[model samples]
Target: MPVTKATDADFRQLLDQHEKVVVKYYADWCGNCRLFSPKFKRLSEAEPEVAFLDVNAESSPEARKLANVTNLPYFAVFRNGELLETLAASKEEAVVELISKLHAN
Candidate 1:
């Protein structure tokens, strides 16, 4: 699965369709976001059933607002279109935990 470029129009659709949706808020110029992109992609590939969406923080204001994102790279996990957990503090291990919990549910 490819990283989804999330916009205001498509964001809700992706959330509605997938059992688990992991949305990553990033910026094109942010170094942290750049470093995290590959990891996110690899995670998405490993879990093909999960929908991974990306919202460019610098460009997509609607998406950013919808997700209530403030950091350079923010992660939000939704199950059945309802937000299950949000992790914006930990580095990589946090994301792994989020994925694990999703699989468990």
Candidate 2:
């Protein structure tokens, strides 16, 4: 499945109602964001149980600010709406690894 877009309204419901989530903060003009998009989607397809949200940093200013994402392609994992991990890497493998680790917690 394609990555799901999360708006401010849908964000809370998805988080509060789910067990695991991978929230990706990205901007349209960001090269890294472009590169990471498919990889993130692939991961989402690989792990269907984990909810993946793609938020445009430009569009979701509040989410960007709340998540403290100063850079594009930021990654954060949440377990039942609680932050479990934050990753700084842009590589798909690193993201997958981080999610794997966080899921273990």
Candidate 3:
């Protein structure tokens, strides 16, 4: 699925609608965030069934707080609206593998 920009207002409802969700937290000015975004998008395109959301940490304070994100390029996965894992790295392969394993179980 395409990545959707999100804020705190609709975050819960969005997650409720998807069986599998991946939310990415990043800041526009962060160099690392800039570097990781393309990889994040590629992963989203590869997994069309999963709901992908992005929260701009520098602009969306509410979203950052809701996701409890502390740093740039944070990633969280949810299954059936339940939080499964929150990862700090920007490794696309590892994230994709983890998602595959999680969905399989």
List, residue by residue over 42-101, the lDDT tens digit for candidate 2: 899988788889988788777666577867789988897888778767988888887896
Best by TM-score: 2
The C-alpha stretches of model 1 lying farther than 4 A from their native spots are none
* Model 1 TM-score relative to the real fold: 0.87
lDDT, each prediction: 0.82, 0.82, 0.81
Mark the regions of model 3 whose C-alpha exceeds 4 Å error after superposition. none
For candidate 1, the per-residue lDDT at 16 reads 89
TM-scores for every predicted model:
0.87, 0.90, 0.86
Ranking by TM-score: 2, 1, 3
Q: Which is better, 1 or 3, measured by TM-score?
A: 1
Say which prediction, candidate 2 or candidate 3, comes out ahead on lDDT.
2
Worst 10 residues of 3 by lDDT: 93-102
How much is the lDDT of residue 33 in candidate 1? 88
